[model samples]
Target chain A: MEKLTIIKVGGKIVEEADTLNQLLDNFSALPGYKLLVHGGGRSATKLAAQLGIESQMVNGRRITDAETLKVVTMVYGGLVNKNIVAGLQAKGVNAIGLTGADLNVIRSVKRPVKDVDYGFVGDVEAVNGEMLASLIHQNIVPVMAPLTHDGKGNMLNTNADTIAGETAKALAKLFDVTLVYCFEKKGVLRDADDDDSVIPVITPELFRQYVVEGVIQGGMIPKLENSFSAVEAGVSRVIITLASAINQDAGTVIKK
Target chain B: MEKLTIIKVGGKIVEEADTLNQLLDNFSALPGYKLLVHGGGRSATKLAAQLGIESQMVNGRRITDAETLKVVTMVYGGLVNKNIVAGLQAKGVNAIGLTGADLNVIRSVKRPVKDVDYGFVGDVEAVNGEMLASLIHQNIVPVMAPLTHDGKGNMLNTNADTIAGETAKALAKLFDVTLVYCFEKKGVLRDADDDDSVIPVITPELFRQYVVEGVIQGGMIPKLENSFSAVEAGVSRVIITLASAINQDAGTVIKK
Candidate 1:
C-alpha cells in the first residue's frame, strides 16, 4: 500500500496570512500522497460576530444553529479551504478543496437533540474512502473543510478532528495512513505548564496511565482517545503535533 | 463522442430555494454527461451588505475590491456552491463543487489596469478540458463556481458565462458539447419585450441582422457574441434558455 499522510489543521494556523503561508509551505513539501483536513472555527466565529450572529457553545462544543451553520459553511468550506487550495496550487500542488458533501464523500445524520439541539450539526456515519483513495491515486491532493451533509439536502457543521479520524480509518483499507492532529502545543506534554516537555510516544496503556496521573486531563483526553480509536480502527499511526513541525518527527505518536 | 451538457445558471435562480430546486430538478433529469457553472453575484452582494462592506459596481460590472472579493469567495465558493453540490447529491447526482483553483482547472490573469481597475477580477485564459472530461467520463458532475485563480495564490472573481463557454469549448475536443446559458428569458428573442418571442435557431448571419435591426442590443449583444464565439471555438451547439426549460428543447440554438 502507498503511504498517505492526512494532516488535520486547526483554525489558528490557517486563518492568518503569514501562518497559512508557512503552513502551506511545509505541507507542500511532504512526500507521497497527502490529504488535508482543516478547521476554521475561529474564522467562523469572527464572521458570525461581524454578521451579528451569536455563536453558542456548550461544554466547548458549538451549538450549531442554522445561522451558525451558514457561517461555518462560508468560513470553513469557502474562505479558509479555498485559500489553502489556491496557496497549494501556487506552489504546484494539484489541490482540490472539498466539503464532505462534495462527491457524497462523507454523509452524516443530523445530531438528534439530547439535552440541546445542535441545529445543523452532523455526526458522520460513512465516508466514501474508495472515492477519496481514487482521487489520491490520481495525484489530486484533497483539502477538506470541516463540513458534512445529510443525505437529505442540508449542509451540516462537523468537527474537523472527527473528519480526520473517520477519513483516516476509511482510507486505512487502501493506504498506510498517518493521521496528524495539529494544535498549538508541540505534542502531548508530560507537564501541562511546560510546553517543552513533549511526550515522544504514547500507547493505549500510557494514555490511561496519563489520564489517571492527571497529566493528560481536560480537552487533550478526548483528542488522544480519538487518536487511539483511529489507530485501533486500522489507521497505521496517529500523531498529535504542532502544525509547523508536521514534516519533522517531533510529536506524540499514538500506537496500538 | 459522448454527449456533454454544460449549463450556466445565474444568481437569481440559484439564490432562492424554490427556483433552485426547480432548476436542479430540471438539471438532474437531463440526459448524458452534464456540468453546471453558476454565478452568485446577488448572494455575494447581500453578504457584503451584511458584513458592512460596500459593494461597488462600475457600469454594472462589480468592482471587486479586497473586502468585496472575500465576500464573493464566501458567498460564491462557500455558501452558494456547497448548497448546489449538496442539493445535487440529494438528487442522487454525484456532484463536486469547484473553483478554477481546484485541480488548477482554470488559470486566469488579473485584469490589468486599463481605464478601470476592476480590483481582483480575472479574465479567462485557459481551461484544463482533458482533466474535466476525465471527471465527466467517470460520472462525476462538476458544479463550478464563478471563481478562478491566477496560479499565484489568489482567487479572482470570474464570469460564470465565460467559465461555461470556455469549459464547453475545451470539452468539445473530447465530447459532443452543448453549452446552455440560462437566464430569465426563454432564449434570444426576436422582440426584446416579449417573453414568448424566442427565435429558436440563430446563425451568425441572423445574429448580425438582429443587431442591425436593434433586436439584439444592450447586454444581450455580448451574450450572443459569446455564444457565437463558443460555437466558433469548437463547441457543437450553444443554447440560450430559461433555467426551468433546460431539459425541454425550447431555446434558441446557435450553430456555425
Candidate 2:
C-alpha cells in the first residue's frame, strides 16, 4: 500500500460532533491517510465530575491517581477512542482503535505523583513499530490512546502528544506519511487572539523563540515539541492547525 | 469454560504506588477472572484544565466535546488501563488492555445533546459477549475501558457502571463468577458520609426507598441501577463495595 498521513487530533478539536464529523470527513476522505492518534482530556474530566470525582494534575500533566486512572481508562480507552473509530468507520474508513497497552504496542514506566505514587502515568519509553506497522499494513487506521504497559503489564496514563510524536516517528520510518496536529485554535499565532496571525511555518529556532516569548506555552508547548520530535524523526512534515482549518492548508508546519 | 468475573477497580483505591501495588497483588492472585474494567476521571479532569479545556457535563453525564475527548482517549484508555494490565502481568496474570471498542465488543449510539450532538458520548446499546468470552476463555483477563462504538461507527462516551452492568449481564449468561463494583466509598451507604453504615444487602424495594430518599441519587444511582440490572439479569451475585474489600466479602449485595 502507498504511504498514508498520520493526523493527531487534539481532544479539543473533536469536542463538538459537527466539528469532529467535519474533520473526520475531510481527513478520512483524503487521498492517502492511515492513522489517527487522539487525546481525550475534556471528555474524561467531564465524566469524572459526573461521578463526583476530582482530578489531580502535576505540572500540567495528569497525576493519574487511582480514581483518575479509572476515569481515564473508561473515558479514553473505551468512550473517546471507540467514538473516533466509529466516526471514521461511519465515513467508510476502516479504522481500528488501539491502546498503547494493547498487544504491547507501546511500553512505558509508571511514574510517581508528588511524593505519593500515581497509579499509571507513562513516559512512552518505547514503541513496537513492528506491531504498529502490522496493524497499519492490514489497512487499519490505528486510532491509538496514550495508555501504555509498564513492561510489567500495568496500564499507565501518558501524554497524547508524546505518544503521537513517537508513533509518528516510528511510522515515518515505515511509511511516507504527513503528521498533523489538529486543535481548536487556528494554529500557532504570534498573538493569542489573532486568528489570521498564524505563523505559516516554523523552524527550530523560531519555535524556540516562541516558547521563550511565552507565545507557545502550556498546551501549545507540548504540541510544538511533539511536532518537532516527529519532524526530527523523519516524518515528511508536521502541521498544527485548528480542526476547522483541516480542509485548508492553513497551520504552522514545523520543519526540521 | 467457566464464566468470567468482570472486576472494576475505583481510581481512588490505587492513587499511590502502595495502593496500586497492593491492588496488583490482589488482582493477579485472582483465580482466572475474565475481564477488568477501570476508571480515571480524577486525573484526566485535572489535566484537562491545565490544557485550557473546560470540562462540560449534561445531566451529570460527561458531554464529550472535541477537546475533552482527546484527553480522555489518551489518559484513560492508554495510561490507566495499561497500568492495571501491567500490574497484573508483573504477578503473572496475562492481561490484555483494551477499550470496549477494540473488537466492537461494545456498541452504542450518539446521544443527542439538546439541539446539538454530544461529540462522542455514547449510550451503550450492545455488548459482544461472544468476543469477550473468547478472550476470557483463553485465560486472558480483558482489561476494558468503558467505551463503546455507535452502530454507525462513531465512538461514544459510555458510563463505566453501564459497561460493568452490561458486561456482567453478558458474563452472567455464561459464568459463575461475581460482578464487583469497587469504588472509593466503602460501600453503598445508608448515609453517604458514614462509610461504615454499609448497606450489606439491598432489594428492589430497598433500592426504591433509597431513590425516594435521595440516598441513592446521582453517582450511586447508576451504580445501584447497574447492580440491579445485573441481579435482574441472573448474575449469580452483584456486589457494590470499596476497593479495599477486594478480598473480603463485606459489601452491599443487590438481589433481584
How high is each candidate's TM-score?
A: 0.99, 0.57
The lDDT of each candidate is 0.92, 0.73
For candidate 1, the lDDT comes to 0.92
Instruction: Please give the lDDT score at residue A134 for candidate 1.
Output: 90
**TM-score, cand. 1:** 0.99
Model 1: iRMSD? 0.5
* Model 2's TM-score against the true structure: 0.57
What is the alpha-carbon RMSD of candidate 1 to the true structure? 0.9
lDDT string, candidate 1, B6-31, tens digits: 99999999999999999889889998
Q: Kindly report the docking quality category of candidate 2.
A: incorrect
Which residue runs does candidate 1 get wrong by more than 4 Å? none
Best model per DockQ: 1
